[model samples]
Each structure stands twice: as structure tokens, then as C-alpha cells.
Target: MTSKRVFIYAGGEIDPISIKSIKQDDYIIGADRGALFLVDNGIKPHISVGDFDSVNAEEFARIQGFSDEILSCDAVNKDLTDTELAFDIAIEQQPTEIIMVGVSGSRLDHTLGNIHMLLRGLEQQISCFIWDRNNYITLTDSTHIVEDRGYTYASLLALSPEVTGINLEGFLYPLENATLKMGQSLGVSNRLVEAKGTIHIASGLLLVIQSKD
Candidate 1:
């Protein structure tokens, strides 16, 4: 039997807990300085894809030696970000799921952009998640059952214009057929009340953020 291929994108400032959660069967993909983080943690990337802009010349050379495959991009001109490029390579491998780590710490704009890339994988029916020190973020359009074993606080945000007919079960603060609008904080900081929780939405896109303090 073939083992599932899990891809990890090491950005910067990877949480030790998060690193521990990463399985050995997973394949690592590094994005710029993210490559350095992976090497620092004694992980050799199966494939490294990024522009060397954020990586120093000496560090980039060292990372290239560690990577099985290296794809370099232009520092000046580029359409896709390094994270997106790494995602493309991971998709080519057709992994069971892609769990991105260290993609969310420093830059808010980069974090948001990486989150948006999850939608691309959604279209391909591949589960993708962005994980950092505090949170795991994913996009969902339909009903999702989240087992309470892994996460502490759960939040559902409207990614589209509006999310209607939102229902929550087994949550500290329950909602029935509620409409969650973009930029609304009402859905934030919800706790799971049972061993499992269910979030159902009749329409529109939703971003689920499962976090720990």
C-alpha cells in the first residue's frame, strides 16, 4: 500500500508544536527563506520553489544543495508568489492533502494571499490548509463537521459577499440559520461544546479558522 503524500511549506518562525505535528511521511516544500527554516529544523526539502529575493546569496546556495529539486524564479518580474509556485509543484504531485506551515507569521498580505490560494485547491477537490503558531485556516462552501479533538477555538467567516442559512451545532455559542456577512466578528471566538461540531451553510463561501491560544 502506498502512503499518503503530505506537503509542508516551511515559511519562517515555524512553531515547535506545529513542527512536531508534521508527520515523517510528509514531503517538504520551501518558499524562499522558508527553505532555511526547514533546513534549520533538520528537514531536507523534496523540492524547493521560490524567488531568491528574501534569501541571502550564501543561504540560497546552501539551500540549493539540500533540495532534491530547485526551481528559481526571477527576482524582478513574477506573476505568482513563491507560495503559489510551491503550491503548483505540490499539486503536480497529487498529494492526499497539502498542509502549509510557516506561511502565516510575519506579513499579513502574504498570509491573506496564501489563504486565497486554498480556493484554487478547493476547485481541484484537494484539501488545503494554512497553519501557523496560533491558527489553521481553510475555505469551505458547504457543511463541515469538525471534530473537537484538534482545535480549541473555531471561527467561521464569510468569504463571499454573504453566507446565509448558517447553522452551528455543538458549539458554545450556537446559531440557527444565521446570516454571516463579510467583515463581521460575530462568528469569532467560538468554542466546541462536544466531541464534534458541525457548521452548515446554505450558500456563499466561508473561511473556517480553527485556533489555539
Candidate 2:
């Protein structure tokens, strides 16, 4: 089956490159003030969702006018964050992959929470990642290939208590059947020397983060 990509934009510091990366057929969801950002950029969102607490009445009107559908909630009574709401809607679309942008910003709490959200897609066997101008983050439960996408560094961290039977190939610092434990910096600042690198893990969850300064 052909892959369906869903892009979710949250009310964080957005990368213009991410906005430009959207294709004609890719689905777009704007969360809260992200809706205003999309409409202001001349791209109408397929769906706009959130309590819209971050936007004023005029901005909210613009979002309503530009979005095909709006899922609104009470700002003071909602459980999930605006970004989570958008993520839920994206999952409902049964997308083969999901790319989340504008999810990382000055707010460390929200940024970390959004990073944990990748687990939701991982649990469903969907390819999911959080992308920003400076970082690309993904959680993996199995082996995978990583490409040199011009990022300065590739770091691997154990999301579970420990990731065992791990192997790293095509990287400047290769590993053989190693184990990575949570809170360890052993996998930090690794360089992908080849055109493509391999990350093979036997068990437990791992977070692969490609970042640049």
C-alpha cells in the first residue's frame, strides 16, 4: 500500500522549511495557534483542532474560515493538550507515517511531553517522528537504517529501562552487540560517516535523535 503522510503543526516555534516541505496530497492538521500560522502562510489546513486558547477572536475566525473542519473544546476543561488533540485526529486518519512540527520550543515541559507522544504511534506500528529545523527525533522498537540527512549528530538513548543486543554500523563510532541504558550518554554525539547507517536493536525501546547546532 502507498504511504499516507500526516503532518501535525502545533503552537510552538515552527520551521518555515517544514511548512515548505508539505506536498499536495499530504494531510495537514493545525493545532490552536498553528491554524493561524497555516492560514497566514496561505495553506488551508484539512483540519483545525484545539481549545484555541492561544489565539484571539480575530485569529480564531481566520482559522475557522480556512480550515475544512474544526474540532473545538473548552480551554479550561480539556484533558489533552492541543497538540495531542491534533495527534489523535491524525491517528484516526490511519496514516502510515506522521511528521510533527512546531512541537519543540522554549517550553521544556511541553517539548518533552510531545517527544513522549511518539510512543503512541510506535505502539501502533506507525512510522512517526518529531521534526524541527534543528532536530529529528524518533522512537524505535526494532532495527532500522538512518541516513545522513545533513544533521550534525545522531544520538541514541534508551527510552525503556534498557535496550539490549544493539549494533551500530556505518557510523564513525561503531558498536557490536552493545547495551544502552536510560540516562547514559554513551550514544551521544555519534557521527554517521557513511551515506546510510544501520541501527539494529533486539529488545526495548530506543530514541534516535539527529540534531545540529
Query: Lowest-scoring 10 consecutive residues by lDDT in candidate 2?
Result: 13-22
TM-score of each: 0.89, 0.97
Give residue 208's error in model 2 in angstroms. Answer: 0.5
Predicted structure with the largest TM-score when compared to the true one: 2
TM-score for candidate 2: 0.97
Give the per-residue lDDT digits (tens) of candidate 1, residues 133-211. 7787888888887776477899988889899999999999999999999999999999998998898999998898999
lDDT of 1 at 145: 79
* Residue 185 alpha-carbon offset, candidate 2, angstroms: 0.5
Clashing pairs in 2: none
Q: How many steric clashes does model 1 contain?
A: 0
Q: Which lDDT tens digits does candidate 2 get at residues 19-70?
A: 8779999999999988888999998899999999899999999999999999
Clashes found in each candidate (C-alpha, N, C closer than 3 A): 0, 0
* Model 2 lDDT at residue 185: 92
